[model samples]
Target: MEWDIAKKDFKRYLLLERNLSNHSIDAYLNDVQKLEAYCSFKKTALAQVDARFIQQFLVFINDFSISAFTQARLLSGLRTFFAFLQIEYDRKDNPTELVESPRLNRKIPTVLNIEEIDALIAAIDLSTLEGMRNKTILEVLYGCGLRVSELVTLKVSNLYLDVEFVKVEGKGSKERLIPIGHHAIKYLKIYLEEVRPHVPVQMGHEDVVFLNRRGKQLTRVMVFLIIKDLAKKIGLTKPISPHTFRHSFASHLVEGGADLRAVQDMLGHESITTTEIYTHIDKDYLQSVITQYHPRS
Candidate 1:
């Protein structure tokens, strides 16, 4: 089969069979395209690719000094693509089956302390319309442990404020109910009832919770800039983003003795291993506490 036809088939398989989100589908296709480009340069067909060719592609990518994590992710994407070829197109062998993925070091995520979170929130000027909305944004992000994508796509219909829970659509379009804290719910009500209604919402974005001044849905980049501006205002030197709030939420929960499984559910992690990173953050916190208090010096 031609590379274009194979990729088109792969896209359909990812969407219909795998039920992956558009963003994830794009990433997988991009990874496969890189290999296709390499094949084109080598004058080889997709069906003719072997394990040796796969290794050569890896070496070529490694020449650019990409991070091991990215290399591993690319390899994973290629494996899925080749797997699709084998299953649908009746390819004889999987090139990635013999190729080993690069080992990745698990880097601990940056987390903000409770004081820092409070400071960031307190720095927001609540007098203006956008200020109230921005405060609510930060509250929901920190309180719900939501991804930026989830936060932006949050809907009014999904919020069960009386029950103090919000439904979040997580990775792979999986839905989970997260219990909202008093602070998040309080501000959420303020935004939805008082602040949001005043703004003229554009067509088709009526269900979206957060809206810009244009009455349209807020993009992920806008949320990041809001957080970035707040961090700068607070003089926080740490490199932080929307994900930092999520990390802080999970890390604080683990530090406060919350159940591992419970944290996993709230974070919408597919595997317990993915949630275990917060435990490592907790360990670092504990080590610091002991070092600061203990008279070992």
Candidate 2:
């Protein structure tokens, strides 16, 4: 099969069989395109390609000066593509099977303290129509540790405020029930009942929880801009996005002695290892723990 045809079929496989997100599928396709370009440069056909050619392609990309994390991600995509080929076309061997991903450095995300969070919320001017909605968004983001996508696409029907939980549709269309804080619930009620009712909601967004002044659902960029404006207003120097709230949520919970497994469930992390990064406790908290529990104390 030609590279284009194989790549097309691989995309379908990712959608139907792997159930990967559009973002993930795009990344995988980009990797395949890179390989196809390499093949063209070497004057090789997909049918005549071998493990050596794939290795050379990897070397070519490495020379382009991409970060190790990106290189590893690209290699992972290649491995998945080759595995798909092996299963579908009855290929004898997978070229990427033996390929090693580069060692990655896990960068810890920035975390905000409770006082900083309070200052952010305090800076919101609740008199404005959009202020109420923005407040609710920030509350839900920090309160639930939800991804920005999950927050933006949140539906009114998904909220179980009486039970203090909302159903979140996370990556891979996986749904998890996350407990909502009383503050989030209170602000959400105010936004839905008082502010949102005044806006003429656009069609097809009737069930959407958050809407812009145009009555349309808010976009991811809108949320980022909202947070950016708020950070600048308060003169807060830390670089933050909607995700900073999420990281702070997990970090605060870990600092407050919440169980790792429970935090994992709330954050909808698929693995406990993924949740472990949030365990970076504050120095004061660590010292307090030592003083409170250590026999030497």
Candidate 3:
């Protein structure tokens, strides 16, 4: 099969069968395209490629000094692609099946303490309309443990404030209901009732929860910039982004003895292993306490 045909079929499978998000589909397609380019350089056909060719492609990418994490992600995408070809085209073998992914060290995410979170919120100038809206944004981010994409696309219709839950569309378009905190509900009500109505609602953005001054839905970059500005305002030296709030939300819950499965559900993680990283954070915190306060030196 031609590379282009294989890629098109793979994309269709990802969308129709796997239900992956557009961002994820694009990443998978990009990985296949990279392999296609490498094959073109080596005068190889997609149908003729084998496990040895796949290993050679890995060597080529590794020569560029890409990080092991990125290499592993690329290999994962290729594995999915070849598996698709194997199922649909009745291929005799999948080249990526024999290839092993690069070993990676999982990095622990940075988290904000309760005092720092409070200070970040306090640093907002609530006298202005934008300040109130920004405050609500931060509250929902920390309170809901939402991804930046989820936060930006949040809709007014999905917020069940009376029941204290917000419906979130996570990866693969899977929806989950996250319990909203009272503080988030309070600020969200203020923003929706007092601040949002005052702004001119754009035609298509009427249902959007957060808006820019121009009456359009807020972008992911806008949320990141807001968090960066807040971190700077509070003089926080830790490099933080919108994801820091999510990490803090999960880590704090785990430290407070919240169940792992419950935290996993709230965070919309498909696997408990992904959520278990917060337990490591909790252990690190305990180790710090022991190192600092324990008298048995």
Candidate 4:
């Protein structure tokens, strides 16, 4: 088979046969595509390519203004692609086995302090209809620490108010039960009972948990807009987005002594290592810790 044919089969296997999640498959394919693009940039094709070509691809990617993390992931993707070729294509040898990911220094995510989160939440007026929707959006986003896609795709049917939990279909269609705080649950109930009913329902989006006035599913862009506007109204100087709330959620939990593994499970992280960055400490917090615990203090 041609190189493209085998590549296509590998993608299908990752998706249908292996039941890999779309996000995972996308990462792998994007890596392969980046390699292809790098080659095209140099006027070469995959069939004639080998390890030296991949090393060059890595160096080329590094030369750009990219993070070590991004470069490392790209290297991983290319490595997997070549390995797949060796096994499925019956190649002579695996060419990418020696490739190394760039070394990375872990950085903690920025988060809104509890007071700041409270201020942001307080800034929302419960009296207005838009206020109601925005309030519910904020609660659920931070309360569950969900990615924007998961939050927007949340449905009315997944809500289990009696159990104080909501079902979320996370990365790879993996389902997790996230506890909904009573405060958030109260607002969500308000949105469901009072607000969602008034919005004009778009045909297929009837089940969507968050909707625009048109009752269509809230786009990622809309969620971003909501967060930006809310932050602006509250005069929050830090960069905030729908995802920021998730980071804040995880950070706050970690700071409160929630176990990292437990937070990972709630966040639907496949690996604990991926969730460990939430434990990153800021300079101010470190100073406070030193003063509180040191006998010299």
TM-scores, all candidates, are: 0.90, 0.90, 0.93, 0.88
Give the better candidate number (2 or 3) by TM-score.
Answer: 3
Kindly report which residue stretches of model 3 are placed more than 4 angstroms away from their true locations once superposed.
Answer: 282-295
| lDDT per residue as tens, model 2, 93-176 | 888777777888788898888888888888999989999899999999999999999999999999999999999899878799
How well is each residue in 38-146 modelled by candidate 1, as lDDT tens digits? 9999999888899999999999999999999999999999999999988998888999999999998788999999999999999999999999999999999999999
Candidate 4, residue 198: lDDT: 92
- Better structure of 2 and 3 per lDDT: 3
* Tens digit per residue, CA lDDT, model 4, 237-288: 9988888999999988987899998999899988899898888766798899
CA RMSD of each candidate after superposition: 2.4, 2.7, 2.0, 2.6
- For all candidates in order, the CA lDDT equals 0.94, 0.89, 0.92, 0.84
lDDT rank, highest first? 1, 3, 2, 4
Instruction: Judging by lDDT against the true structure, name the best candidate.
Output: 1
TM-score of 4: 0.88
Q: What is the Cα-based TM-score of model 2? A: 0.90
Compute the lDDT for candidate 4. 0.84
The collision pairs in model 2 are none
